[model samples]
Target chain A: SQTIHQWPATLVQPVGSPLSLECTVEGTSNPNLYWYRQAAGRGLQLLFYSVGIGQISSEVPQNLSASRPQDRQFILSSKKLLLSDSGFYLCAWSVPWQPQHFGDGTRLSIL
Target chain B: GIQVEQSPPDLILQEGANSTLRCNFSDSVNNLQWFHQNPWGQLINLFYIPSGTKQNGRLSATTVATERYSLLYISSSQTTDSGVYFCAPLVSGSRLTFGEGTQLTVNP
Candidate 1:
């Protein structure tokens, strides 16, 4: 069975602080990874996606960035966080053109 | 980019009641998926129906690709089923565009 794991299930960060969220998948290799953010009462917004290591595509321009350091490890980072950056961040993995499986998600609160 | 929309942004039902959720896409898609976001915020995959119908226990889904829409039917809802239902479409590429989701609350 494939499973996705995310670190720091919940975080509270000060404004302008650096941030990093990690995601890794077990039981799968070379799967596509994605980063999505959901604001309170809003739809999930695609922030970034990676098809392979060192390859990332940004869907919406914002302060956040994503990186794929290993075949199954993806990290979402920001040099300086903004109040608007607060949201529930989700990490998902899928085979090319297939349905995605999501992690439990990280609830980030930027103050 | 394909547009995905889910109807009845909010729904309330009594336990054991039957309910239907609808999802309409703006364009043709190669993939369509239904997910249940539990109260704890974990997304559980319910169906991967791009076309045709699939049933799983008390839940069933039908995707009319030709009409660019899909339907999810929940028979005999339970209190545990209270949560958000999301529908997303995989367009030309493998990226998925999610809908706003329909919030369903089943009362006991």
Candidate 2:
């Protein structure tokens, strides 16, 4: 079975501080990776997606950027965090023509 | 981009009760999935019903692709089932668009 791992399950950072959330997939190679955010009372919003190593597509323009340095690793980062950056972040991986499997998610709070 | 809409934004039921949740999509999709987000904010994929009907234990799902709508049925509801149910449909690519979700609260 394949599993997705997201680090720093919860985070609290001061505004203007840097942020880095990591996600990796085990037991799957060359899987498509995605980053999504769920704000209070809102639906899941796609932030970024990667098809392969060093390839990324941004869905929403914001202070966030995603990178896929390796085949199974996807990272979300910000040079400086904003108060509105607080939300539940989810990482997911999927094979072609299949349902996505998600990580446990990271609850980030910006102070 | 496809638009996904979920009905009964909120649902309240008693234990052992039965309920149905609906999802409608504005355009044709290549895949449709159902997910359950527990109170603790953990999302578990429940079904990947693209066309036919499939069941798992007390939960079942049916998708009529031609009509661009899907239905999820939950029987003998339990407190553990209280949470938000989301419907996500993929449109012609790897990305999936999600509906706001159906918040279900089951009472004992």
> Largest lDDT belongs to which candidate?
2
Backbone collision tally, model 1: 0
**CAPRI grade, predicted model 2:** medium
Which candidate should be chosen as best, given DockQ against the real structure? 1
Worst 10 residues of 1 chain B by lDDT: B88-97
Supply candidate 1's per-residue lDDT for A103: 97
* Candidate 1 segments exceeding 4 Å error: none
Global lDDT of model 1: 0.94
Query: Looking at candidate 1, what is the lDDT of residue B3?
Result: 81
Model 1 compared with the native: what TM-score? 0.98
Worst 10 residues of 1 chain A by lDDT: A92-101
**lDDT of each residue in B1-108, candidate 2, tens digit only:** 788899999999999999999999999888898999998889999999889999999999999999999999999999999999999998866898999999999999
Looking at model 1, residue B89 earns an lDDT score of: 83
Off by over 4 Å in 2: none
- The Cα error of candidate 2 at residue A98, in Å, is 1.3
